[model samples]
Target chain A: MVINVKNLVKRYGDLIALDHFNLEVQEGEILGLLGPNGSGKTTAINCILSLLKYDKGTIEIFDQPMSPDAYDIKRDVGIVMQNVAVFEELTVYENIDYFCGLYIADRQTRKKRVAEAIDFVGLNDFIKFFPKKLSGGLLRRLNIACGIAHQPKLIILDEPTVAVDPQSRNNILEGIQKLNRQGATIIYTSHYMEEVEQIASRIAIMDKGKIIAMGTNEELKKKIKSGEHINLELLNPEDLDLEAIKALPHIISAELTDHQLVVKSGRDKNNLIAILDHLKDQNIAIGKIYSEPPTLNDVFLEITGKELRD
Target chain B: MQVYKAFFRIIQKNRSQIAIYLVVFMVLALLLTNAYTPPQDTDFTKTRFNIAFINEDGDSELVDGLKTYLGENANLVDLPDDPQQLQDALFFRQVVYILRVPKGFTAAMLNGQEVQLEKTIVPDSPSNIYMDLLINKYLNSAQTYFAYLPGLSQDQLVDYLKVDLAEETAVTVISGSSHSANAEKSGYYFNYISYSLFAILILGVCSVMLVFNDTDLKRRNLCSPIRSATMNFQMILGNLSFAVLTWLVLISASFVMYGSYMFTTNGLLLLLNSFIFTLAALSISYLIGNLVKSRGAMSAVANVFALGTSFLSGVFVPQELLGANVLTIASFTPTYWYVKANNEIANAVSFNAGNLQSIFTSMVLVLAFGVAVLGVTLVLIKQRRVEA
Candidate 1:
């Protein structure tokens, strides 16, 4: 395991930020921590990094105990905070150089890394620009560049794409994948399920400061009863029997609205075929048919009884 | 080392603001030195006044002796015995003093009878007091000789009085030199430094510290591999080096302005006092930097603390001239002790243990303030760490 957090419990006065939180990140894999705001993702990350004082539990990194003074462990870890953290007085190149210098005492090596970081973030043209002069997306890019310039073994990014524009968001997401390919174990946290589903090899769904479910995309989808959604445009909707469609095998719910028949089914491969056969038997002519696979939101809703965004 | 380098980079960015304070203080110190410096020439000359001697009594040896003595110190003017002419002469300042011998005859004084001389003079003139002293000296001497030496004739008595009064005491005037002038100038320069040093340190050190203490930036730094102790040491090194550099600049400027005096014992003490004060100011800046949240609050704190302490202490005004109550309140500020030490060093006549005791005491007080404030800042940092 690259990072292991066992039975971690952190509290802020009467509020429990993390309750028996346990996580184990394998080497060379992207573990996406998916949750809404205030789901103890950040608190757990802080505890794992030893940046916070936990009420109870232990965190081990690289098979060694983690602590505030764990310099050896800290040397291999990089963090990109939720907020942009860079010196406003320093230019882009200078900010990257300063952060890189903290880890790499060698001047020449630091110079090369800083340049690479600038190029990696596509900030070469604005290397001399101060953070205040940059747009929001460019500033977030600069923030990431400062964190990853040192090329640590484990990189943790907390909501790195929050408030970012679509173009910059794609650039950042692509850059994260490239960093992962560079043989660094990564722990990515975000509330956007699509982001986690897109890049995360394994997803951990968190709610109320605990992981409600943990699995790969396919495995997590299998944990829920929702399989797929089927929608059929009806030409003769007045003749359609909604109660009969609900009575069909593997059909969990069925509804008809605006001359379209929408049906939700359990985990069964032949649910769509059965629905289509019933429609044909009833002589109900279907104009168009659409089938959609279950999303991460569906898995979240099935397990948590609420939307992932909620 | 990276943090240390960044600290100076921030200070370099603020060099323009610091330069403005330096130039303003230098100009002010120069102007004040010029305005208060005395003239170079130190020659002495006796003051002479115009007077009229009226002889109301008949010509006698006694009257003649009095007239001759008065004529030596004053320019005896010729005036009519008429009252209107005498009044006009006195009013017009043509004669600042007038002496009239009464018609008592010579026997009144030979018989040891107390006879008064009538005189009229301008009222409230500085020369009037000197004239009175001269007259009293001559008459009192003559009376004593007549009473004690009754055997001597009037001519002999008058002659003896003249001989006795003719003997004058030698007077010497100490010429003011450039050393004392420079000392005074240096005193003013160092006293004014209290304000500039406080302002610059607060603005520069606090500004840099504010960046380092930023919540996001601090968290980022903590997450780095650098040890917290090493980071703190680098920060202290940066703040100390900046403060010392500022003090060196101000001290060097003093040497340029007031050449040889800055090397004197008193001047060296002034330098020591200011160095101590610089440390105190740095501690204060650290406190304010940690307490404040924004640049606007930093500016306000810098102005209020620097200008307020300077005015209440003796930076803009002399401590001697400050009210008792005001000094009582100002005694709490480090600047007050700093200016007090500077004043003591300037006025010191000898570099003896007794003389330097108060100066060292004041310097120690300033140092104590720095130490005390640093303690408070450390406690605050610890409390904040716990809270975080």
Candidate 2:
């Protein structure tokens, strides 16, 4: 295991931020910690990094206990905080070099790594620009560059794409994959489920400071009764019977709104064809039709009875 | 070392602000130094008065002797025996005293008869009292000679009075040092340094520290591989270097302005006092840095603390001139002791144990203040870390 956290409990006065949180990240894999805001994702990360004191927990990294003074363990870990943490007085190149120097004492090696980090973030043209002069997206990129410039064995990014523009967000997501390919174990945390689903090899769904479910995309989908959703635009939706559509084979629920009809079904093949034949026999002309596989939202809604974004 | 380097980089970025303070202080020091003119010789000199002597008793041996004696101490302005002219002269301050000798005044004196000489003088003139003493001395001596030594002639009496009145007493001033003009100028310059040093250090050191103590930045630094002890050591080293560099610049400026005077014992004492004050200012800056949460608050604290202490103490106003209540309140601040020490250093004529005792005591007090403030800052830092 690259990171092992067992029975972590953190509290702030009467409020419990983390209640018996347990996580184990394997080597050379991206572990996406998915949750809404205030779901203890950051608190858990802080506890694991030893940046915070937990009420009760055991955090071991690389088989060694983690602590505030665990310099050896800390040397192999890189962290990019949720907020931009670069010094406003320093330029892009200086900020990267300063952070890199913290890990790499050798001047030559640090210089090369800083240059690579800048290039990786596509900030070579703005190397001399101060953080205040950069746009929000560029500043976030600079923040990421500062963290990863040291090239540690394990990297933890906390909401690195929050408030980022789409283009910059894409650049950052692609960069994380590249870093993982370079043999760095990564732990990514965010509330955006699509992001986690897109890049995370294994996903851990968190709510109220505990992981509600943990599995791969396929395995997690199998845990819920919801399988797929077929949406149809009908010319005469008022003429269709929702009861007849719901009574079809493999169909779990059906609803009609305006000129559209939505049918949700269980895990069964040909559920889309069954819904199409039923709509045709009812003489409800279809204008458009599409099918969507069960997403993390369906799994979240089935397990927690709440939207993934709520 | 990264922390240390970054400290100076932040300071370098703020060099323009620091330079403005330096220039303003230099101008203020020069202006204060030039505005004052210290006394050259603190010795006493006799006052001479303008007087008109109307000798109506005419060219007698006694009258000639009196004229000769009056001429030695007073300027005898020639004027007619007109009352209006004499009155006008006295009123306009052209002459302060007018003496009119009545006829046969010498004969009356020889016959041992008391006769008064008529006099006109300015009212409430301080110099007139001295003229009165001189005339009384001459007349009293002449009368005594005529009465006691009846065998002596008028000429002999006049000669004897002149000889006796000519005798004088010697006076001397005692001081351990010359109290030169340069000493006064340098004292003013160093005293003014209290305000500038406090302001600059607060602005510079606190600004840098605020950036480093930022919540996000501090968390990021704590996650790094660098040991906390190492980071603290580098930060302290950076603060010390900046403080010492500022002290060196101000001291060098004093040397340039005061020349060899800065090498004197009193000047060296001033330098030591200022150095101690610099340490105190640094401690204060550290405290403010920890207490303040933003740059705006930092600026406000710097101005209030620096300007406030300076006014209460003797930076802008001399301690001697400040009210007793103000000094009592100012005694709690290190700048008070610093200015007190500077004042003692300026006026010290000797470098003996007795003379230097007060200066060293004041310096120790200032140093104690710095240590106390540093202790408080350390406690605050510890509390913050534990809370974090």
Candidate 3:
């Protein structure tokens, strides 16, 4: 395992920031930590990195105990924080060089790594620009480049794309995939479900300082009763046999409202064909048909009964 | 090492603070030294008193001699015999003094009777009183010479009195190093030095600190492999580098301006004194940096500390003129000790052990202030780190 945390607990006065948080990251996998705004995802990451004092638990990186003085471990762990942390006075090139120099001492090797980082983030044209001169998206890219320049084995990014434009966000996600392909374990945290779902190989859902659920996208979907939803619009719904449609195979629930029939099926059930067959037998005139698989929000809603955003 | 280099780089990028300090220091030093007049300066040749000479008596050798003497000493101005014009000239500062030679003045002096020379002048004017004394001295000296020396006639007496007496009795005097007016004046320039040094140290260190204490940047650094102690040491190294640079700029400027007098023991003492004060100012800067939360707040603290200390410690005014209670309060500040040490060094006749002991004690006290403030800062930083 590239990263392992067990029974971690942290507190701030009367607040419990992290409670019995346990996590494990395998090599060459993107582990996305998904949560709401105050779900202790960042607290868990900080505790794992040994940046904060944990009241209880053990955190190990590369199977060794983590500490603030763990140079050997820290040397191979890179962090891109939620906020832009580069010096405003330093140029893009200088900022990358400064951060990289902390891990690599060889002058020639550091220079090469800095160049590669700038290229990796597509910031070659902006190497000489100060942070204040760059757009917000460009500055976020620079922040990422500074952290990953040394090519560490394990990288932790906390809300890296919180306020970025769509294009830049895509670029950042692609960059994370490239880093993972280069044999690096990544821990990504974000409240944006789609970004996490698109990039994370395994997902861990946290709430109120605990890992409420942990699985792959398919496994997490299985934890809830929700499945693919099918919608059909009927031209003359007044004569439709709604009772028969409700008794279809693998149908968990069915309802009709405003000349439309909506059907929800169980997990891994292909009820769309079955519903259409039933509609054809009844000689029902369909105006429109649509299908949507259950999203992370559905799993969260079924599991917590509250909007993930709320 | 990288941390130290980065810290220094930040300081180097802030050139505006250094430039302003240097410019203000140099200008104030030059202007103060040029505008200052030493108390011992006495070149009376430039002084010319105004007088209206009235020779109502017929021309005699005595009267002519007196007229020549008065003309050499005073600028004789013609009056229109109007009282109001005289009053206006004196009131408007056109004339600082006035005198008149009465009639029969030569005859009264020949008989050696008590005869007085009438003078018109303003009341309660000190310069006019001084002029009256001068006129009496001149007449008395001539009368004494006329009584003692045998002369062919009164005309010959006037000629005999024309001999220059002060030239024959002139004496030469030399001053010791303790009394060197230049040394004293150079020491006075340090009053401004305290203000400039305090200002620069506060602003420079505060700017450096703002970058280091940035929330995100600080978190990033803490997460790095470097130990907190190493980072703090490097920060101290950077601050010392900046303080030394400030000291060198001000000291070099002072030396260039007063090199002839400063190449001595007293000069070295003054230099040492300033260096110690710089350290104290830097410690104060560190304390202020930790207490403040924003750049604007840092600026306000810097101004209050620098200007406020200057006013309380006699940098803005002479220590002798300040009230006793104010001096009692000022003794608690490092600037007061620094100025005290400087005065002692400037007033030393010789580099005796006792004088050296006093100077060293003052410097040590200033250094103690820095150490004490730095200790508090370290404690506060430790507490904050523990809480974090």
Cα RMSD to native, each candidate? Answer: 5.7, 6.6, 8.6
Query: Across residues B1-388, which tens digit of lDDT does each residue of candidate 2 receive?
Result: 8999999999999999988987887788778767977766657566788999998887689888988899999888999888898889888999999988999898888888889998888889886788888889889888788778999987788878888989987766543233467777788889888888988899999889899999899889888989866887898788889998888887888888888888889888999999999999999898888788888998899899999999999888889999999999999999999988888888766778876898899999999999999889877775554234
lDDT of 1 by residue, A134-241 (tens): 999999999999999999999999999999999999999999999999988999999999889888999999988899999999999999887889989999999988
Q: Say what the interface RMSD of candidate 3 is.
A: 1.8
Candidate 3 docking quality: incorrect, acceptable, medium or high: acceptable
Q: Which rank order by DockQ, best down to worst?
A: 2, 1, 3
lDDT of 3 at A215: 91
For candidate 3, the per-residue lDDT at A194 reads 95
Q: Which stretches of candidate 2 lie over 4 Å from their true place?
A: B39-43, B47-179, B386-388
Span of 10 residues, lowest total lDDT, candidate 1 chain A: A267-276
Model 2 chain A: lowest-lDDT 10 consecutive positions: A267-276
Error of 2 at B342 (Å): 0.1
Model 1 error, position B245 (Å): 3.4
Return model 2's CA RMSD, one decimal.
6.6
- Write down the C-alpha DockQ for each prediction: 0.49, 0.50, 0.37
What are the lDDT figures for the candidates, one per model?
Answer: 0.87, 0.88, 0.84
TM-score of chain A considered alone, across all candidate predictions? 0.93, 0.97, 0.90
* lDDT tens digits, residue span B149-189, model 3: 73547667666667752233344445533247767777888
> What is the per-residue lDDT of model 2 for residues A25-69, given as tens digits with 9 covering 90 to 100?
999999999998999999999888877888998999999999888
